[model samples]
Target: MTQQDVVSTGSTTEGRAPKGKALAATERIQAPVGGPGRGPMGGGMVGQKAMTFGPSARRLVAQMRPDRGKAVAVVVLGVISVALMSVGPRILGQATDLVFSGLFSRTIPAGVTQEQAVEGLRRQGDGNLADMLASMDHVVPGQGVDFDAVRNVLLVVLAIYAGAALLGWLQGFVLNTVVQNTVYRMREEVEAKINRLPLGYFDRSPRGELLSRVTNDIDNVSQTLQQTMSQLMTSLMTVVAVLAMMIWISPLLALIALVSVPISLLVTRAIMKRSQGMFVAQWRRTGRLNAHIEETFSGHSLVKVFGRQHEVEETFAEENDELYRVSFGAQFVSGLIMPSMMFVGNLNYVVIAVVGGLRVASGSLSLGEVQAFIQYTRQFTQPLTTVASMMNLLQSGVASAERVFELLDAEEEPVDAPATSAPAVRRGEVAFEDVAFRYDEDQPLIDDLSLVARPGQTVAIVGPTGAGKTTLVNLVMRFYDVDAGRITLDGVDITAMPRSALRGQIGMVLQDTWLFEGTIRDNIAYGRPDATEEQVLEAARATFVDRFVHSLPDGYDTVIDEEGSNLSAGERQLVTIARAFLTDPALLILDEATSSVDTRTELLLQHAMAALRTDRTSFVIAHRLSTIRDADLILVMEHGAIVEQGTHDQLLHAEGTYARLYNAQFAQAVA
Candidate 1:
């Protein structure tokens, strides 16, 4: 089968996408396939089991360690803000108590003088008896209320609230800046990490999955930071402050409120445990569904041509249904948290109100204290619910963070050795010495391979499908290092030079032509960004690319489609050849470079190739015998090894593999 067929059939496995539409880098880091938790569609959430808030989470936090000062400021501000807000209930309760005391003192049996009320309060050991009676001087006994005292207490409450508001806003502002900046830094790190990752990493990972890590996972982390950072601090502080105030008011009432804590904890833990798996499943299924949609849409033409639209739709429906089922389960389970907490909270409320009413009647507590304790009870339960919800949000965010960290922590391509040196100039001499290589350790591909090409030589490599023609070119270009042995340029090991320096001297044109969305000139000059217009035009003319450019309305300035869909296959190939020509490298590797063009265009390209090959080492990988008939050296490869090496005519006379291949093509042409 052709490589395209292999890719299409094997796409169910990870790392493969539809033809002509490889997933971008952002999509490759999504959840893994069939991992720990099973989504409705049987897919696994990406990074669900990779790491939690353990060491990996600590490392994620360490990313923000640089902003530790701002973080500390936010914490300090939050604590003060919550503390000030918590005092509002108590202060308001004190106002209620004052009003009640003044009204009680006024009702003093209607015949008692103000002196008797004051003396009675003093006898009862009231700490503020003098102040209370002085404030009541304008009030008639049993007829007037102390409005001045109420007003003063209310003013104090107002000041406390205003202070809390100001601090809360300041805290929010600083925390937002901290979270956004941290996310920004993480994105930059991810981008840098992508560059350092070896090509083999991409080969084994799906582009969609990686894209998820860069975009989706990172965004999740950012969102969680934005949402939970302030809430976590506030909730925790509120809970502590409310509990302390409740205890200060009356320890018996505080104990009554505390009964709900264990119940709430048990309910929250149960629900969280069940919903955690569903959450993982939901995200995994979401990734799978997205991948399916991407693949189907990208290959819509193939589906219609092969009349598989029904099958494709059925597959989509299956995945969609699974996603819906798991999503519903996740939402349903998590949804139960609020109502359950409310039930526990209400139960606590009932107990506090009943016991507090008895205490008030028995004179151990006042009405205002009971009211304040009820408010504290409500405040306490609220934080519990807020914390539960935040935990869920944090868990998902942590999962996504783990995935992003995984990508960042991936093994990078080996750096150039300290002693490595770049050559002053390239001489175009190439040699492969006793090379043994494999994509997998157990399945050897290239074995004991050796060859040499002197300066200015054209070496043709011809092989059948799956015979390692492309692999050989990849090794020469240093896309993959040899497992054993060494490739040398000018008698110096290529590995001794930096990868960029090694690849800088070589240019490659592959069978699959890629063109970005830009003007035709831009694509042609991509390999040599600094090329002059004259140089670009010269290369274009040599590759016969000018033939089509002149016909277009925009000439060389025409904007190509993202995939160069506006240009014919042969036209795109010619443009890539021109791009390679403009690079003007000492070594050129062309793999099936002319396979797309017609015979006439091939003839034109041959003229260009012949001129371009002067004083340069060229490796031409092709199946067409006619193009390479005059090559100085012809290497016949079969099953990853060079089975025959000779001139084309010499091989034809020997009647070996190359002879049979050339004869068959010749006979077919004559027919």
Candidate 2:
């Protein structure tokens, strides 16, 4: 066929124009199956429900097991700090007692002894003052406020507080290190897990949702740990230390303060139970919203071309509103914890004050002790309030943790056979033996399929969409393993070899051209990172990428944007072709490799591909029959079964599936 015979209109061999209504449907971003509004799950069931709080919280803590030593240090330093701080209130009480005694004792006439002043007060019928003096310790009669002793006691109190502050800072520093290290390890695990997962996982999951798990969720976990871990530990410790001080000062008042513990706990537990599910919902909706945005932006041009901006905006608003609803519910429910705990704490405070004041007046406890007990009450109540308030952070963090953990727990690709290696000699022969496979068990696809492509043979596969065309290539690449039978490379089972080793021998250029953000040279050399400049240039020239590179301002050094929008479709396709060519693989797979280029560029790419196929087994899937007319063998597939197989002329003569397809394209071309 002449070039003119193959170049009539922008249409595929499937008898459809490239920019027809079918393209519009294919271009619009469809939501994933389990995406927003479908159910409680997000990212293909990454979050099935709000995981049980206990287990999720425990698992999060388990991640920090490796940092146990640092955690222990944090605990120890916290205890020491709380201990030093606890002593400050008692010392302050001592200073207060000293000043009070000296002032009252000085009110007694000068040179009067302490017993005489007290006896005189009692004789004057001032029994209340006498009782207060009796309750006070270390009071010297006729001594004015001893500024020297008070100064000494205040100095001691300041030093204790200063030391406690220093230790607290150190504890926080150590705790920060632990939290950061734990989060770092978790991020590394998530990164590694992504590589271990099978292709099917990604096929079902939305990209934006998965990204939220890897990025936003993990970040939330880190922030939660940073905010809560230290505070929780210190708060609990303060409660204990303060409780002990309270009991030492007055058991009755201590019992009154203890009344709030159960009430605070009950309030926190109830609020947490209600908000846990909301937090999970909040993050799940967040992932869904993110997926929607990512898909819309990725297909922004398609959306605009089809004038679907309003539709995209509507979908985004719906998901955004859903996210806002869940977020508000989670926050509002968790926010109730603080006020409820505070109310209980304040009630306990009133009771403690009433009981302690009466006890002080009854001469059962010193004024100084009452002062210390009140301070202890505040310390105790404050920590309880803190722990309760942090329920918000705790719930949010654990919810995010569950999402990330779900990803970590996803099914991974089967491990390769132990001690396996690729076949020797790299003969480039591939064979499928009655392979049976299906994405869904109930929906059979590619059943009992068998075929072989000998070394150096160019096998072209033509099939309609959903005809298992891509599945065949995927099986060959071991992206998904066959459910039955086996595929072999050079007479050895491909599964017996490691995926990396098997893939290293095969080079593929798909229908979509992917170019990362890098220079033209870098994109071309992506398949062979160690390729020398000379080798890269040779590949570029062979694939005709040099044709356009020379015209650019930076030649091969011109950078491609993230979307590769800087280059035209044809240019990007040529760069990808060059990328595959640079690999010099033992086998090649081209899936509509020339679909994006114009007739002229497609013809040039055909020649470049012909050269690239030399001495290498090649599997070419194309919708354009003209591009594969010279293929050594052409297999016509429909519904996962090959209906015809022969050279172009033989298949045309047979007047079957291939003939009808070829005739239709010919008719269109002639018209």
- lDDT to native, each model: 0.76, 0.82
Off by over 4 Å in 1: 1-49, 53-57, 109-143
Per-candidate TM equals 0.87, 0.93
Model 1 lDDT per residue over 113-161, tens place: 7777777877787736434454343435675567887899899999999
State, as a TM-score between 0 and 1, how close model 2 is to the true structure: 0.93
Worst 10 residues of 1 by lDDT: 2-11
Top candidate (lDDT)? 2
CA lDDT, candidate 1, residue 661: 92
Per-residue alpha-carbon lDDT of model 2 for 1-671, expressed as tens digits?
A: 11111101111212210111111111122334533222222223233645699999999999999999999999999999999998899889988888888877777777777777778889999887777777777677666788898899999999999999999999999999999999999999998888887655555566788899999999999999999999999999999999889888888889889988988888899999999999999998998888778777776777788888888788788989999999999999999999999899888888888888888777788778889999999999999999989999999999999988887876677888864555568899999899998765666777888889999999999977767776788788877788899999999898888777778788887777767788999888777779999999999998889899989989999988856888888888788788888888888988888886789888888988887899999999998999999999999988778889999999999999999999887897798
| Residue 506 lDDT, candidate 2, scale 0-100 | 83
Cα error, residue 33 of model 2, in Å, equals: 6.1
- Per-prediction tally of clashes: 20, 0
User: Would you give me the overall lDDT of model 2?
Assistant: 0.82
